[model samples]
Target: MLTENVHIAVPTAFSEDESLHIQGTIDHIRSLYEQGVKSVLVSGTTGEQHSLNLQEKMELINGLEQEEELMDNMEIIFGVSSIRQKEAEELAERIRPTKLAGIMLGYPPYVRPTQEEALIYSEKIIQLSNKPAILYNNPNRTGFDLSAESIIQISKIDLVVGIKDAGSKEKVEHIKSDTHRNDLHFYAGGEEELEEKVLHGYDRLSSIAGNISPAKISQWFEKMLKQQKVTTQESEEIEAIMGQVYQGNAIVNVKKILNQQGIPMGICRSPIGNV
Candidate 1:
């Protein structure tokens, strides 16, 4: 079982020429590990996984494999999603034998498959990876919403452990009431409106802001989960951090902040940071 309550969705590093910089990515992850961060999600939306080709992703995975300390010590979850099901399947298979902790299985963007098709896609990837799965459903981005019925059905699969951005409070409650599983975790996608999310039964965090302020964000989230009050000073600090991360494009802002800190996160792949 994936045990981390919070995981940083890290950005993939790109060179000046916009090439994948595998070492740079690993270096940032190493920095987080050194800072007492126990888990991270690579190649998710923050990692710009859609911008990376299969070959580059394979290279990145291989690079992570070589980092024995990080691989062995952290619950390093990888993101697996592609417009093509075959590509996602292949990627899942590649991760099947890896030291990777688990997967953030996102719905395919643009194609917007039907509920049945989406369920099939989810099951196939979950089967191939044979790892704990956190189903990611972003209707705004993917234009395909996984209904509560679908969520309940998918949650029955033992490999399926959780769901990210699983929708509003009512939907989450519905799923909770309908599903028989006791271990399913509800992960708020980012730090935005997080207090409300936690109140609404979001028990886990796939954190974007944590990339920049891992300890602070994690601590703040822990307090929220515990129903503890955040001091005024801490609240102000979190507001500042949220502004830095959520202003403009979040991925771009995070890369810039990380680069300033000397982690060599580089720039977002073209079009994104293309000023």
Candidate 2:
């Protein structure tokens, strides 16, 4: 269930303290697609979407849809996270006008609950949207861990096709092992290189590093997909450079590396607070 292309997920693009030029966001995504990104996700945590107001989020999604270039081959997945179900559903409905490919949702202050509560939340989103759904389970940020059983149960609905696995190795293994034969697809989040989840056997990868280091990141991702291993030296350089600040938050280092290579990734929306 590999729902995205280019195998990278750039989370937290705009920091709260920073100023976001609406045109800047669209240009950034368009540039990535031209660089060979098959799919691009907007308004996720990486996009700093939670920090945006409801109207702002709508504007962003609508803007992307209007891009004739984006409407062609690139798949754009909009983040649908909200403090309440009604607001979330409203966002989903708003997305109907755009050709948004998918919607991703995770925990929020207003909807914290046990697995059953989460299941209901997921169902409501699926029924409300025409686009596919991505269930984000980054417990470190979301507070409550979304159980694999919860995901599997919810995934029974056709819309919930993918899960962003941001849990620890043990948790990931359980879900991967459990869903070995299911229709549910697992999306590897964060530092895919550091974790080696791709090396260990996950076929699909979602790298934030891909933002700035499109060519290099794509090379490694393609290599990994092909079962080819980069030298420890090559891998180490990537990690040391991208594993820290100034690139795009945790991903800024990666952006720095890319900037060195001649890409136009200006800045990470600025201040980079709490990336």
Candidate 3:
């Protein structure tokens, strides 16, 4: 059982006027490294890819590779989600030349395409980009479930390398039983699941919780890998505090966490509001 380090899919902090130009974001990426993050995912859902225009999206991708800490140690995954297949493929192709670690594509949000349709979408993206892509199968966020059968079949294509999982125990188990290759990576999200999921052969975690309390997130990730039993010594505490902060002001709490560490932290976009 080889487990990779956790990845912080950071949410971009914007300026007051719906911009993600703050220096605090890059600074935060550095801070996350200090806390034991092995990878950084930019322009993903956590990074608010949905909010930014094409230019802004590319800028965010550019920023991650520019940071020294991120450039060297961290594996940077460009999370590209779009309503149109051609658009996602185009973005994937354009950034292939950059120092991007890989591509992570979530299911197109607006339309719930059938599994076959999704496969075609992924195939076209691969054909267009000719770069490795991570299949981001998050059903809770995407509406329809992307099946393991589809993913395993898609894995035959050289481009689809991994998946950021958001399915249930059974679904994961199904994939686990079906999937056998080491090149294909599977990362889990959500805080409560860290301990349990790691035990069950998950390779990595692309965590939102890892953002605010990365030290704790790192501890949990390592403990889950090395220690006999999982420890929630830090996880529970951070969640309790962040839970309140999240309720009142997620943006402020995220910013405070980033600023405390010296990242290019700033405000959230308009649609996101205070959080």
Candidate 4:
């Protein structure tokens, strides 16, 4: 089980020439591990997953596998989604033997498959990975919303442990009532409107800002989950952190911050930070 309440969705590092910097990426995760972070999501949106080709992703996985300390200690969840189902399936198969803790199974952006097709895609990837899965339903980005019915149906697989950006409060209520699985977690994709989302039943966080301030972010989130009040000073500090993270393109801003901190996060792939 992915037992971490918060996992930083880390960005993949690239050189100035935009080639994958495997060591740089590993170093950032290692930094997080040193800060007492329990888990991280690699190659997700922040990691420029789609921008990475299958070969590059394979190399990244190979790189992570070589880090014995991190591989043994961190609950490293890899993102597995592609416009091509075959590519996604192949990624899942490769991950099957890895020590990777789980997968964030996302929908194919711009493809917008029907509910039935999405369900089938979900089942296939989950089966192949043979690991706990967190279904990612970012309709705003993917153009395909996994409906509450579809979410409830997919949650039956047992390996499907959670859903990220699971839509409105009403939708979450509907799924919660229907799924009959009390264990199904609702993961807020980022910290935006997070308090409300938690009230709406988002029990976990796929944190972006945590890439910058792991201890502060994780502690604040844990307090919120426990219904503890955030002190005014804590709120001010978090506001400053969010300003740094969410002020610009989040991925781009994060890379710049990590770079400034001497973590070697480099930059985002072109067209993202290009502007």
Per-residue accuracy of model 4 over 1-275 as CA lDDT, tens digit each: 88999999999999999999999999999999999998999987663788999999999999999998998999999999999999999999999999999999989999899999999999999999999999998888878999999999999998999999999999999999999998999999998899999999999999999999999999999999999999999999999999999998999998899999999977777788988
Local lDDT at 59 for model 2: 76
Candidate 1: residue 35 Cα off by (Å): 0.2
Per-residue C-alpha lDDT of model 1 across residues 1-275, encoded as one tens digit per residue: 89999999999999999999999999999999999999999997673878888888899999999999999999999999999999999999999999999999998888889999999999999999999999999998889999999999999999999999999999999999999778999999899999999999999999999998999999999999998989999999999999999988899999999999999988887788877
lDDT of 2 by residue, 163-268 (tens): 7764556765676676654666666765544447764445555567667666776676667677777998878867754655334456456545444655444456
TM-score of each: 0.98, 0.81, 0.84, 0.98
Q: For model 3, state the Cα shift of residue 119 in Å.
A: 0.5
Off by over 4 Å in 1: none
Q: What lDDT, from 0 to 1, does candidate 2 have?
A: 0.66
Backbone clashes counted, model 1? 0
lDDT, each prediction: 0.93, 0.66, 0.70, 0.93
* Backbone clashes, each candidate: 0, 11, 11, 0
| Local accuracy of candidate 3 as per-residue lDDT tens digits, 1-275 | 11346767777777766666736667677777776777777777563676776677777766765676567677777777687776787787777777677777777875899989988888887666566677888776667678879988887886776777736677667776777766777777645555677666666677776687777666766766786564466657766755844565555566666656566566666555543
Which stretches in model 4 have alpha-carbon errors above 4 Å? none
Question: How much RMSD separates candidate 4 from the native structure?
Answer: 0.8
